[model samples]
Target: MISRRHLLATGAALGSAAGLAACGSGTPGQTADDAKKSEAGTPTVTIQFWMGKLTTGEDAWYKKIVKQFNEAQDAVKVELTQVPGDAWEQKLKAAQAAGKAPDMYIGVGNNVSVQVGNGELADMSDLLPAESWDDLTETAADLVTVDGKKYAYPMLFEPQTVLFYRKDMFTEAGLDPEAPPKSWAEVLEYGPKLKSKGRFGLMMGVTGADFGWQSWGWQRNVAGHLPISDDWATAKADDPAYEKLATFYRDLYSQEIVARQALGPANDSSAFGQNKAAMMVQGSWGISQILDEFDNLADKVGVAPLPTHDGTGTVPVTIGNMKWMIDGKSKNPQAAADFIKWAIAGDDPAVLLDYFKTTGYSKFPARTSVTEAVASAPDADTLNPWRKVIADVVMPAAALEPQYDWTVAEAFGKAMEKCMRGDDIPKTLGAVNTEIQGIIDKLKLAEKAPQ
Candidate 1:
């Protein structure tokens, strides 16, 4: 769910906390040889941790955590490295090839299969205590497991997209502001009414169609995490759900219910923010952006679960943004795993809380306890309302991102673009299906399936 906005520096939303409050501590004995008292009698282990690119706010906040981590524990010192998010894959590949990977890294969920497929990560089942592992949201927890062996520590998660709407627009349109559209049918029904007010009713992302795919995939009741077949050898592009989605977009476009700007180069949420659109489905990150850029309209904005087909239920499409993993070749695997567990869900809620708050409540901590702690904070009500939507609705419905190669997702995006432009849905999907299945075949996906 790292969007273009997250990468670009907006003025710092939440600055780093001055200091961290002690909340809890991990069991002492599990430290193992990850650190030992030097001849100087000081116990210290240098944890080499690499994180993807960060916004100014994220960088400042993370450095504070590293500072606090060093101050709070005498046994572990994290040597933080910031890698450009775009270059992470190439950097990781080169490092692995050169036999000098870092101890741990922050990476995307989609890269899990590739990393595990290439033997880049270490088994973490023993390092992250079972109880600690259990505390993670099940969907996030599922992403790190390969072949039934846990390979990464779940960190931040966000629903790939959520329903963001202007309550004022609904009220202006004589609709219930408290009750947003609950289904695609409702969206179609309300869209024109809102459009009459000189606003586009719906705004779907057309940039890469990732948001569109997520929304459609959920409605079709496709398992959110895995868009392809269970065996990872076929793309289910031809499923009936895709056609319905394409048709929906076409109808919205034809009726002028969807913003024309959304079909252009503008960011998906831009139309909504500019008051030209009543609603758009975007990542939780969009909520903060709106609040920061348009403070006066902050109270008018609201978030709801991504609408389902008939408002009956929703399939989880919450995606793992970034996860922490230990390198298989690390000399300090234990220290690396311990660092992730401690920094994320360990006994301290303050550090994790600081992390999320600093991101302006964009990152959803994967650990249930941390999530609840943030939800109940003193200023919880003061933050964006979407935090509640994320906690109450999105997390509960979160589905695992379908396991497939990144290329498959890109291909699906291209197919969706073609469908939106009036191409035959079935034909486009069929071609996409063949293209993706061909990828699976050429890559020997069956052989790569987690064993």
Candidate 2:
């Protein structure tokens, strides 16, 4: 998950030319006829690649791997560029409009569906080897596939909702740290017991945008559907299950179990790290920040999948992943595919393993081979003990984040905020349903929904 803080930080340096140089011996706009011919008269193809700038050292890993690939191979040359997260959409759109877009670029999470609809991404099913596609974890593979055609190659996946708590605080509050809350009812029951004068029992997003995206997993747990129906033609917010989910959060705010004002964005762990809350609901990437900022609290932290409504053992998490997609109009589709396969799904797992290590093992690997490599590493467990819990418990049960229009998520989020602010639940939900139906009709989303 990309936190608001990270986005703001990168957004500040919007026009700066960072990581814009092309790697290897290839230059941008090199045509097939311009490729260097070998002794066999076969040309070496060069492809352009772009990725969003991530705060987790992902850019560095990409640069390193691209350099390594260029030095080790002669058949395909790759030119790499890193774009700021905030500027990515505008820049990529301009490039594509001018017909100078990079051959391949990183696919933004949850927005790939829109890109696919716009014909921005190329079909990868016939470009890469079938076994390479088979190597991806089922959940990861499903995320990048639309209508049974692979549009992107997944790099990593992070669970969007994980329970992180303080062991010492749990003990002080007369709760068992070893057994965290397994249901929404347990969370309510335990939250009050953990509250004190300065610190609250829980920390989570309470704003409209925060609640909108952050509630995806919880919505699945409670309602088994998003605000829109599967066909994307009707609004489903009026369902009793959605009302129940909204009312639960409203009670949490009204009773002061959680802060009336948000401590930080849902993706951030600063409040928990500063001891303002005993427990927090955050993405799995939060683990990386905690370990880096407060190494002393490493031993005091505990992780578990977010609890479901009835404690029925459902994981209640949305899988957040980063993937690479080729441009639909790329002149070097095969060369671009070769680079992606070598970096992520190749026989050698060394590059991918090093990336996981650099991320502090906070992000989960998308490929089974990379998972095995990480598990067999000597320092895997010692470096991060939560890996097993996330892999064995969270990944299997997690659902793909909804790929519907952003306005649909915003509509549901605003309704959730209204209920939390003391508005009548039924009235607010009814209004939300009408508003969402308007969106569906205006956008003709029913016709766009993948079959």
Candidate 3:
């Protein structure tokens, strides 16, 4: 798999050498064909749908859903294709370049803006029924909206890095397990207490110093547009809050409050699962992972809102939510829309319940009714806690990744790495801010949203 840094570098080099070619013809969606019919004699339409790869049986579950939808319907026949996550972007680009894009494909973070800007994704604001659109959670609906139009419909929401701590560890440290730290200052204060028990207070990045920390700061709802200016033109790498965040992590490393392994490629959850770390910030999906892998530790683990700078509030940051979008060049637009409506926003409790169960309750549906149903179901005890966390903590104050440019995020990540290495924090951030601004100018990101 290509690292995002390498992908951005390749895009820049290619841009300088030849420029990105416009892909796809402005073709209209195909209408139902009379050439093919089901046993009932209704005209049939086959729509091509593509999704990214998943290992945890979600791939099979999606395929099963498609088969069920096909069997239950006569007007539409869906063709499903699973694309590897690493290659999905390249494949979509290639197909779009050749004017053969699939009817529907999954849209990930920041790509929604990129594709919408390039006119590669279909306008979905008025495509689905208004009720369907209204059913989406505010954050899910807002994430796909670019220039006041919805381009994609969210299927699931996986908020990143809600604070997961060990109740046993908290009790051992003479702290109240019922009351987790409410602010970053409290988290830092707990470090020494946890360290006395031979455990780190928190483990954030474990493998390449991922972007979780950035989201930590963004969720604080710091006074200004984070990592970017309000206009979305200038890089805000030099923002005081960003510098403070980087410095805080640097201090954590220097003080040995956080293990060095977490800064590397080791999964932090493993450390948490093994009781090596007293606390760590992880996605909602990690709850199922810890439960499934280490059932013995189930009662010991606890989930809460990730700490803010001053306990102001918490906001949900997108972790692994998948958004479905219609391809701009799709031939079966209405058929594809119909299928999405049925699968996602449809008022079918049985189907939605099965979808929630099929993924082991790792995915949270974006539809309010589905979420409520799952929470009320007596057999869904494993997921009921998470539903409360999502409702009370995550969704109410949700915010998006900077969305201006992926490179901005990459640049900030590099700056954080330099800080972790004990480099001059101010100088490193200053240089990165200037460099990112240069990239923004070169890509004309200020004039248009970037990929």
Candidate 4:
């Protein structure tokens, strides 16, 4: 329940006071075996897994992963609890307060930051083979790690976002579908051509803001505005990257090429799929959905990295993986960690691929060997296509929240809403960045001071 700001303060204080004592232990808690002894008499160790709706068609793919896991193992039975991903923090906090919570659960970018920072997760440091884990992608691997201890594996892999264009729209606009814009200017130039079809050329216009603004915001992240580092805070809203970002957004808004109400809760935009909008930035999660919805989607839906600020050949597909972390307080840490190991092992992951027929590779396996196994998976028609592209395009980009705090994003959300409302670029951005800097300064001071 600790806020990230408070946690940073506590960490700094404890680091000074605990000094050498904190360095020897894997996690700042009682050992897993100690917790297990308290639950020794249970007939079957049902390891509670708080996960997104994936099992039983409430997001069936996740369920299949757990179901196959249960059938495959004898040491533990996974009790899969469906937790809405968006509200996972509330779920975890509520469950913790009630003394009823999952032993192992899925984690996304924000969850990892909040939970791991609070030390609510099991430090899978020694539970799983460290060598087996060494093969993970750095950004993907770092998703669940805080300090030197790791709590989750980057399970499903993808860049933060991908740029997809409507082939017909592009052709009509006289732009090549295969050759996407590489810089900020080209996208602006192409924005107007799709107007003949009554389609907005750019997303992030008020109409597509919810799903699209983050993509545009992430353009700054790919440009290297990270959250923190050993040297200093990596991301600052006032950074030139963000200033540039706001200016670019202002231009897009002024051009009137972006759709109105595109970003609001109910704004309808099928222009990208309807061959109306020329291009849109989306995540790997959208690939299968796009393929399913768009007629002749594969040929018509061109996939390319998003445009960069300086054409530095560095595209920021935001980097992250769906994560699974075990509760340090769980009664079955060993069993829980075992299940995670089994789920990711070679050939074993193919079982999950078999379960989700349509959203194949939507949850790309984390391991390289598993990726290879999926490459030749029997049901690859559903899985392989996305895996190849996601793997290729997901260059090491920025994570959503750098400090394991949503405050930065929350600040951006406010700024973005105002930007969409047509606020002044400099003053609005300066205010937001100041707010972000204020948070960062407090966290930094807390980190440096003694507890």
Best by lDDT: 2
lDDT of 4 by residue, 1-451 (tens): 1111222222222112111223333423323442343245321356778876432332665676677655543335677778754577787889877877688877765455456656678788776666547757565566666677777766765554667677777777778766777787887787776566556776643432342335433544444544333344544555555666656666777776765556322112245666546667655555666654555666666666677866556565454456778886786676676666655532344443453344545556666666666677676754335454545555444344333345656676567567655787667767877776677686663453212
lDDT of 2 by residue, 412-433 (tens): 9989999988999999999999
Comparing candidate 1 with candidate 3, which one achieves the higher TM-score? 3
Clash number by candidate, in order: 6, 0, 4, 19
Query: Candidate 2: deviation at residue 211, Å?
Result: 2.0
User: Candidate 2's error at 132, in angstroms?
Assistant: 1.7
Per-residue lDDT of 337-408 in model 3, one digit per residue for the tens? 767776775655455677676555656777777787776777666643555775566756655555666767
lDDT of each: 0.68, 0.80, 0.67, 0.57
Error of 4 at 236 (Å): 3.8
Regions more than 4 Å wrong, model 2:
1-48, 73-101, 196-198
Q: After superposition, how far is residue 253 of candidate 4 from its true place, in Å?
A: 2.6
| CA lDDT for candidate 3 | 0.67
lDDT agreement of model 2 with the native: 0.80
Model 3 ranges off by over 4 Å: 1-46, 55-57, 83-101, 125-127, 147-149, 171-175, 189-201, 206-209, 212-224, 259-271, 274-276, 310-320, 357-364, 371-382, 449-451
Q: How accurate is candidate 4 locally (lDDT)?
A: 0.57
**Lowest-sum lDDT 10-residue window in model 1:** 11-20
Q: Report the number of the highest-TM-score candidate.
A: 2
Candidate 1 off by > 4 Å: 1-48, 54-57, 71-77, 81-102, 129-131, 172-175, 189-200, 208-216, 222-227, 233-235, 254-276, 291-294, 357-364, 375-378, 381-384, 447-451
Shift of residue 221 alpha carbon in model 3, Å: 4.9
Task: Report the C-alpha displacement of residue 325, candidate 4, in angstroms.
Answer: 1.0
